[model samples]
Target: MFDTLPQHLELIVLTFLLAGLVKGVVGLGLPTVAVGLLGLVMPPMQAAAILVVPSTVTNVWQLAAGPRFLGLLKRLWGMLVGIVVGTLLVGWLLAGRNWPAATPLLGVALILYALLGLSNKRFRVAPRHERWLSPLIGVITGGVTAVTGVFVIPAVPFLQALGLEKDDLVQALGLSFTVSTLALAITLSQHGSLLQADVLGLSLLALLPALAGMYLGTWLRSRISPLAFRRCFFGGLLLLGADLAIRGL
Candidate 1:
């Protein structure tokens, strides 16, 4: 939030609305969609600052709504610690220093993430393998988050590869996202990139539309084909991500 309303206030509101819709329909993508779309006009970090509240509230809710929270947390403890270490290491990128590479990095991350979603590839990580790979992926994901303000690159893929049931997978995503959001918030506060208190209220208002859109999307989920919708969603991300990547380059 700024001292005054942003020139593109409507766009920002709509962006959150759409992002919420996506998350409601698919279970995730609020940060990915919101940061990527908003990046077209603002730095990814700025957009990410606005995202802290909504992402945290929603993700915390998601994490709590699942019965598997404790189990997931125990299994993901190492990965969670790694996320913190990695985010702190690269937090400088967002510490009052919007490097030229950040935007491009975000674009590239979105592109890679979109491509992975669209590819329909499935990976498996056995328990033996998870012992080492979990923390590694978390660190990679945290580094990516610190650089790009988006948190889903390797983390999402790694989570998917765990071969959890549908409910467990959803809950797992919630846990990871909640940790990542809090980690990013802490880093941003340490640097004041998250914004000052006066205008922070404006960003919180975004939750209204986001929650509303999520409600709508939840209603629509049973009425539509999620598989078809997801393809379209990833396809759109691919195009948008390419545009951002090209502009950044």
Candidate 2:
């Protein structure tokens, strides 16, 4: 059935565009913003499926725009692998018509994301301790991602804890998100969640708006401090999360 487009096509376009802008300015959050917003209308699994191409493309770009790929790979291999395993292991949560269960989980994930960003406390994981903690964080991140299509939970905080240089931290996030996107793709495919040709086409077309928004965001990032924007972003997300949570409950 080659339909013209998914329902609410305009909304979908805006979502990718806004999500890309956020990612460009913040250097992350494309999938988070996209999926979270999309969750308002679709299942997490469906939102995740639509997310695959854009997420992989943007994250790969972010990963390549940085230096020292091999070093980041070496340092984060355990967590990367853990993300794949955890995503695959828990994918069944979205394999069936489990939308009721996923919504609250997505809401909770958003709430946690807001809380962590709003707080000023910086959590640090010692160098030696990262060996064990990184994989654990990855696993937890994957599980949450599997259910909610959001991957920042534990993972971003853990990455921040490592104390990498600014550039290195940004690149590391790209690498981690790249893996997470690919893993979620596999899980969705395994469950036939991505079998629709129309959906795939829609996802591909979404990249145009996403890239355009990213370009705009990158320009804005160079001029603005983003402090106020960050607060607004998290605040809006917190309220959205709370609404979703109540609806889900």
Error of 1 at 150 (Å): 0.7
- Itemize residue pairs with steric clashes in candidate 2: none
Kindly report the root-mean-square deviation of model 1 from the true structure over all alpha carbons. 1.5
Give, for candidate 1, the lowest lDDT window spanning 10 residues.
Answer: 193-202
Candidate 1 per-residue lDDT, tens place, 126-243, comes to 8899989889988998898887789998999999999999999999999999999988888777876456674367569878888887888889899999999999999999988989
Q: Which segments of candidate 2 are over 4 A away from where they belong?
A: 1-5, 92-96
RMSD of each: 1.5, 1.9
Q: Which ranges of candidate 1 are over 4 A from the true structure?
A: 1-5
TM-score quality measure for candidate 2: 0.95
Per-candidate clash tally: 0, 0
lDDT of 2 at 98: 58
- lDDT, candidate 2, equals 0.86
User: What lDDT does each candidate get?
Assistant: 0.86, 0.86
Model 2, range 167-235, lDDT digits (tens) per residue?
999999999999999998888777654546667888898898899989999999978878877887788
Per-model TM-score, in order, reads 0.96, 0.95
